[model samples]
Target: MRKIGGLLLCCFLLNGLNGQHQVKTRKELQREVIRCINESAQQYKVMMQRLDAARFPVTWYAKEDKLVTSGSEPWVGGFYPGALLYLFEYTKDSALYKEALQKLNVLAKEQYNKTTHDLGFMMYCSFGNANRLAPKPEYKTILINSARSLASRFNEKVGCIRSWDSDPGRFMVIIDNMMNLELLFEATRMTGDSSFYRIAVAHANTTMRHHFRPDYSSYHLVIYNPANGSVLKKQTVQGAADSSAWARGQAWGLYGYTMAYRETRDPKYLEQARHIARFLLQHLRLPADKIPYWDFDAPGIPDAPRDVSAGAVICSALLELATYTPLKESKGYMKAAEKMLQSLCSPAYRATIGGNGGFLLKHGVGNYPRKADIDVPLIYADYYYTEALQRYRKLGMKR
Candidate 1:
């Protein structure tokens, strides 16, 4: 409770400082922050009421039609709780926290919904991260056990987290595994278990070995045999399978490595991040305005589809990279970050058509198999953009 109070207070201090005169003293900033959090709490309360009234459950939706805010059904493992956790972060309301916790409790117990590739976004985003910042026993047990379950899915011979239930008996990895590795890592920390962390590092090392191309751009799918730790195949699970780069896959690589670097301070992870960032920047035809198309070298150029989610995610990665880089590299990455942020904040990419939905960018294509959300707003894009905006405000042109 005290931690939550502190968080809410910090939030107030953060927002309260905004839209006000330049503050010459820390005291003034502190005062403004408290006021802001209080005001924000009220707004969050109203939002919670509206959100709940709509019946939004915190679960991943595999298809567009399943995205209705409320009810009993679940799409995948990550969606619903992830949204609620974000809301709880803003509000610091116990009710929201408990509600989200309750959902996680249920998902943790449900044995059947555990086979997907989204463990990080599903478990970590919903509870693991929260546990790091705020410890709750039920929340902790559920998240750790959930991480263990995901870890169990790892085929020791493959050296990677398995993906795609269709290949049920087989072990394969996807580019998205990078994000979920955090679950394993955090689970290890929470449980004092070496097996979990070891598995995570092995998966990451294996990914580095096979998934990335000579240019540092990555393939979307890699088949590995857990029995002997050999890669059977590496392929693109999305995009034109002829080795075409999926822009979001590239973003995942960038963000994921940067995250790995943050966790281990490994030079290889940092180097990989730089290599991928360079490939993305140099090859991607980012305009003076700066958002990128769905692929860096997407065929058909101007007519190619755009994935604003990539731009938002890459911006977040670049900023984190800048934090540890040398001055020159940091400045360059910072400038790129600003460019991407401007691209999203600009009229061209953002959606004004939504009915009070906070989705910042449209055109995130998940699997063309579900062609429902083409050219429409995505929730994560908005979440990441908001995170970037908050960071930008705090750091003040950090480059």
Candidate 2:
């Protein structure tokens, strides 16, 4: 009788939480998302009117009130184009598609860039989306080569891809590196190259073993001994402290593991994703709006800057997770994701039609510690926000 009572209590609690939050219907959300995308397309058109092909946007500088752009090799170069592709997919606007292709043309040279571990961000996000939409032969070749470049960074000794080389002596693997595995997985699917799949699995397994706390909150970076495969330090570069949960880092882990599960059908990966989601959702510090503070443990509680990029990422991942889980397990995830989408569509986070420097979402905390791109509009935030809308649209269509 006690066990049966506990189950009933659990169901009651879940129902209460779901009932307390009222989200927009699919039709309402679709209209709002489409309006936002149309506004974003127009904003980009104005911004791109003066942009040189050699530069790509990274974030908006509110103090300067201008778009911050970088060269072709920056990790964030692909996101602008990726967001454009999402807009194109949704609006079927030829201008958006043309601009995205132009940016991808400029971004194509990064396929051979082996100096960095971000080829996935630089190449795959751009070309991979292009291939999915257009199915061009050249895009596949670009992605396959980009995967090869990313694979070149893998060290068997550390059982992970090297994320940074700044320290020279230390082999660094970051939680953010988890986001890159999608490129490798896609490569295996495109070319039947099991090597890419193996490398991705090795990295995911190694990360799962070391990068997470018992509670499943992830550290930002893990430094390993390059020669002996020994962990030297587990630290955070962008989080509040070495021990705190960085909002974006956790989001990356959730999204990455969710993607990993989809690609490999690994139960461990799914469990990990669910665990991380629980940590994020159940944390007391999470704001009522479904967006998180820059760090879960960051000082100032309600005063800390919200990371819309993190929220956008989690929103997209949860929508995908909803499709994969059982109905009972999926209800909360879907509701939470819908709430996030509603929050993002609100005036507080979503930029006005002509504002926010051509970005879709506003007020993302890029790296609070580094004092970089704080409380500004970010390209990746827009990319993932649009991606989430696309996913939600597909789900609604299925219904």
**Could you say which candidate leads in TM-score?**
2
Which residue pairs collide in model 2, if any? none
- Could you tell me how far off, in angstroms, the CA of residue 110 lies in candidate 2 after the best superposition? 0.3
Candidate 1: give its CA RMSD in angstroms: 9.9
- Write model 1 residue lDDT over 265-362, tens digit each, in one string: 88999999999989988874654445666666666555455676778789888988988799999888987887676556544555443222423354
The global Cα lDDT (0 to 1) of model 2 is 0.87
In model 1, how large is the Cα lDDT of residue 314? Answer: 90
Return the top candidate by lDDT. Answer: 2
The TM-score between candidate 2 and the true structure equals 0.93
- List the global CA lDDT of all models: 0.64, 0.87
Residue 396 Cα positional deviation in candidate 2, in Å, after optimal superposition: 0.4
Mark the 10 consecutive residues where model 1 has the least summed lDDT. 14-23
